[model samples]
Target: MEDMDAGRAGTARRWLDKLRGLIDPERMGDDFLYLLYHDALARRLGTCHDQRDNLYLRRFERPQIELFDLMAGHLPVLTLAGRIGGALLADHLAGRDTATLLSVGIGSGGQEAAVLTALAKRGRAPGRLTVIGVDPAVGSLHQAERAIRDTGVTLDFHHVPRFAERMTDQDWDLVRRAPRPLVMNAAFALHHLRDTASGADERNTFLSKLRDAEPDVVVLCEPDSDHHRVALPERFHNSWRHFHAVFRLIDVLDVSAADRNAMKLFFRREVVDIVGTADDEDRYERHEPAETWLARLREAGFRPMPAPAESVSEPMPPAFVRHDPDSVRIGFDGESILAVIHAVPAHA
Candidate 1:
C-alpha cells in the first residue's frame, strides 16, 4: 500500500512538472517542436489565441483531452491494441522474443510507456519493444526517458538528430532497411504537416519505405476532429484558433479570477504570425487541416485502427470556471475525437 501511494505521489509530481515545463517556453527548446511551431506562429505574425470562441477552445483542447482520455481513461484499449499488434507482428517476423517495437512520437513517454509497461507486467509485452522514439525535440525525449525509467523494457531514445524533413536520404534508407516484424507507432504528430507538398517531400517517402520494411504493425493516433487523415486547409494560417481552445478551458474551468484577459494576452501578444498567411495581417486564424492528413496516411500505406472507448476510473474534474458551458472540450470546443491508424506489411 505504501508503495502504491508513493507511486501515485510521484506521478502527480511528474504531471505538475511537465505542465510547468510546457507552459514555460524557455525549457521547451527544440525538443517540443510541436509547441515550437505554435510559438513561431504566435511570434512571426503577432497573432493571438483569443479564448472567447467556444469552438476554438473545443478544437484546441481536443488533442489534450484525447491524450488525457486514452492515457488516463482508456488504458486497456491501448494496452490490448499495442500488445496484440506488437505480439502478432513480432511473432510473425522477428521469431518470437527477438522482435523490436518502435514508438514514433514518444511525447513525454508517460502515456504510452505506462500502458505498454502495464501490459508487460501482465506478461504480455511483445517480444522486445525496442521502443525507439524519434523526434528533433531532445527535451521531450529526455523527460520521457527519465520518467519511464527501467521498466525491464528495452527503450532506445533516438534524438532523431534533426527533424524528419531534414533527415538525409541515407538515414531514411537505413530505416527502410530495418528488420521486419516491428511495431512503428506515431501519435498526435501527424497533423503538423503544412501541406501535402511537405509530407510528399520526405515523410511520405519515408513512410512508403517503412511500408516496404514490412513492420507487422504501424499505428497512428491523432485528434478525431473531422480532420483526421485530411489535409488542413490554407485557413489554418489565419490564426492560432487551436491553441486558444485550451486557454478557454483553463479560464472557464480552472482559473480562480477567470482572468480571461490573460488568455487574450497570450494569443495576441504571444501567438505567432505567419507573414504570407491570412491572419498574418494579424497572425491568428491559420489552422491546420485534417484532410491532407488522410491522403498522406493512405499514401503511406496505412489504414485506420478504430480505437475503442473506455471510461476513466476517477476522471479529472472538468475545469468549470475556465470552461464555456457551451464549449464542448478542454482542447477544442467540443468532445475530443481520437483516430488511431494501424498498418501491416502488404504481404502479411
Candidate 2:
C-alpha cells in the first residue's frame, strides 16, 4: 500500500505541474503591472514577467543594440554568421571555378555577407563574386548593395521586383535565367508569407519548390515562442519582464523616469494589437513554429543542424499567457536572435 501510494503521489505531482504550466491562475487579482499594490511601505518584489518589457530595452535608440549585443555576449550567433555564410558559398559553388554567388534580400544585418568575407579574408572568396538580391523592396537591395560596396565583395544585385510571397512561377523562371547557378541563403525572410492565405499546406508547397530549385542552403530564423493569447493585464506583465531581461544583459537600460514610463505605456497599448488577421487570411501566411520547423527541414530532405539555444534568456516561469505573433520575442540567452538552418546535401 505504501509503495503504491508513493507512485500515485509522484504521478499526481507531475500532472499538477503540467496543468499549472498551461494556466496562470494564481488568483493575483486584476492588476497588470504589479503582483501586489503597496502603500510605499513594503519591499518591491517583482513578478517574473516584469523583467521582459519595462525593465529591458526601455531606451528608444538602443532597442536592437540592446538585443544583439546582449545575445552575442551569451551565444555564438554573431560570431558564426559570417563564417557560416562564407562556408556556404564555398560549398555550393567552390568547384565551378567561378567567383559568383546568389543571395535573397539584404540578409539580416549582413550576417551571411560577413561570414563570406571572413572566408575570403582567409583566402577562400570567389575571385568575382556575383551577388543577385531578389526582393521587391528596392530599399533592402540598396542596403545589400551598400554593404557589398563597402565590403568589396564583387556583387551584382538584381532588383527582382517581387517579395518572396509575391514571387510567382514566372518570377522564379526569371531567377533561373540568371547566368550563374544560384547558391543562396535566406536569413529570416521566409516567415513573412505574402500576406496571410497560407496555412500548413501552402507553407509546405512553397518550401517544396525552394528545395526543388536547390539553393546552396536556405538558412532562416523563426520564432520559438509557444503561441498563446494574453489579456491586457497579462501582456503588461510579460512585456515588462522581457524588457528587464534584455536590459540587464546589455547593462545600459538606465533611462529617465519619463522614458521608462513611456515604454510601459507603449507595451500596454500593444496588448490589443491585432496580431494576425482572420483565419481565412491564414491561407497565404503561416507562422513557423520552431519544433515544427526542425521537423520541416528533415521532411523537406535537408539535414538536421540544431541552432544553439543558449541565446534564450534566463527562463521565465512558464508564461501564463502569450499572444499570437508576440512582438516581443525573447531569446534563449535573453535576446531575440533565434535562428536555425540546413545546407543542401552535396548529391542533392
Model 2 quality (TM-score): 0.54
Per-residue lDDT for 64 in model 2? 44
Provide the global lDDT of candidate 2 against the true structure.
0.44
Residue 257 miss distance in model 1 (angstroms): 4.7
Q: lDDT tens digits, residues 70-97, model 1?
A: 3333233233334333333332333245
Q: Please, what are the lDDT tens digits per residue for candidate 2 over residues 1-348?
A: 122124454554444334334433123212222311110001111112333323432433346445445444432333343333344444654434354344555543265456555656767655556666666677767776677666655555555656665567875665556555566566545655533433345445656666766655555555442222333234334444543333333223344543433333333322222121222232222334555666666677665443333323333422211111211232424344333454453355
Candidate 2 at residue 203, lDDT?
Answer: 46
lDDT of all predictions: 0.43, 0.44
